[model samples]
Target: MGETIGYARVSTSGQKIETQALRLQEHGCSKVFQETYTGGSTTGRKALLGLLEYVREGDSVVVTKLDRLARSAMDLGQIASTLEDKKVDLVVLDQKIDTSSPAGKLMFNLIGAFAEFERDLIRERVQEGVNKAKEKGVQFGRKAKLTKQQLESLRNDFAEGELSKGQLAEKYGLSRSSVYRLVKSEH
Candidate 1:
């Protein structure tokens, strides 16, 4: 009924944007915006942002797959919400999600909920891993690689006033902070 605008993107330069473009043209899209680079995030994507900016109330944005539009579920929700806000709809050919339909709206909500759930699960898994690591006495962040012997040598040097922290770090292939930690750990 209104203008159909196609937006196509390939993660890499080598991907054939032509197939999607041809599909869009066959679907009678007036024009298409094809991006050659990966849009992993919303911040640096010029073409995707431009497509969103140019979309009007009566126009529809088409894509081959939902993933082509976003990298993560959060990203998908954000972009979809923008289209919803602008009174525009999305036609993800692979997903068969025409946001103009009740089924499509339901599908979108379901997908968003699933994505959120996935994020929560990943967070929980990470916390569990951290807890397990702590139980095993596995230190997080950068570890103190120096042995007791090396630390003892550092302490001996410091006690004799032969080397400052900087010189000790230089001599031992460690940072000044590492030297300080080594000195503290020895005693």
Candidate 2:
């Protein structure tokens, strides 16, 4: 039989992974890889990459929770697929997910679908909220670069041909496109 390898992760330095490491050790994990990096970010994930390279067939990967392994269902699915390809088992302690059984595989699939659906709903709600706020005249994003008086002067300068769009942009410390947009708004 192969050994059980554990992985523990915490999102920030302020958080501790000691609890998770202890849990994995108690749960029969001989080796544990711990890291303090955001699960969503793949860059600089040295521990995870090392674990993936080190595991072999008959070895099982254990984690305190599914979120400790991945940020999204798509990412989870991809990681699960890689483990399956190498004939390695995945055990998520908190979620009670073990890929060694048929039922576990089914549950993982369902969870992935639900996760994706939840993200989509959140995005839709946010977009709707932004639209409603716009209707209420609540502007979002950065404030305008040029105020009303400056825009009026810019329009006058452009109309009088005293300066070109490029010259106006340089004088006002704005982009040429901004100068064009301000001039167009007057007509």
Candidate 3:
């Protein structure tokens, strides 16, 4: 059996890992490795990598929470399963999950489910909000330099030779390319 190790993470400099470290040590962790950084797509959590390398069969790795280990369900799943493959058990104290037990396994699945569901719900809500805005006459495109009516008027003026491309651009606060586009559209 290898020594029990601790892994703690803080997303920002203002937060402290001392509480998590102390708890892990209290839970019989012999050595603790910790780091502070925003996480999600991090393939470079140095302390976590170090802990993984330090462990052997029967070695335990403790964390404060699953979210501290990963920002998303997929990332959490990968890291948790990797630890399991290494014969390293992960104990997330705050989540009350210990991957070495059947109950813990159930909890892991539930956490993953909830996390995925939350993200999906948020995405759906955002789309619904945008749809509602559109229904309420909100514009869904980039601001136009000239409206349809203004563009048509410009095209008519250019066709009648009342406005040259460069002259139209200067007069209408449009680019030469835009004036040319209007003239071409008229033709």
What Cα-based lDDT does every candidate model obtain?
A: 0.82, 0.87, 0.81
* lDDT (10s digit) by residue, model 3, range 69-122: 776778778877888888888888888898889999889878866876776798
Per-prediction tally of clashes: 0, 0, 0
lDDT of the structure predicted as candidate 1: 0.82
Report residue 82 deviation for candidate 1 (angstroms): 1.7
lDDT of 2 by residue, 36-155 (tens): 998765557899888888899999999988778876778778888889998999998888989899999988777767766776798799999999999999988999888888888888
Candidate 3 overall Cα lDDT vs. reference?
Answer: 0.81
**Over 4 Å off in model 2, which ranges?**
10-18, 35-46, 144-146, 150-187
By lDDT: ranked, best first: 2, 1, 3
After aligning candidate 3 to the native by TM-score, how far in Å is the CA of 129 from where it should be?
Answer: 9.3
Which residue pairs clash within candidate 3? none
RMSD of each: 5.2, 4.6, 6.7
Q: Clashing pairs in model 2?
A: none
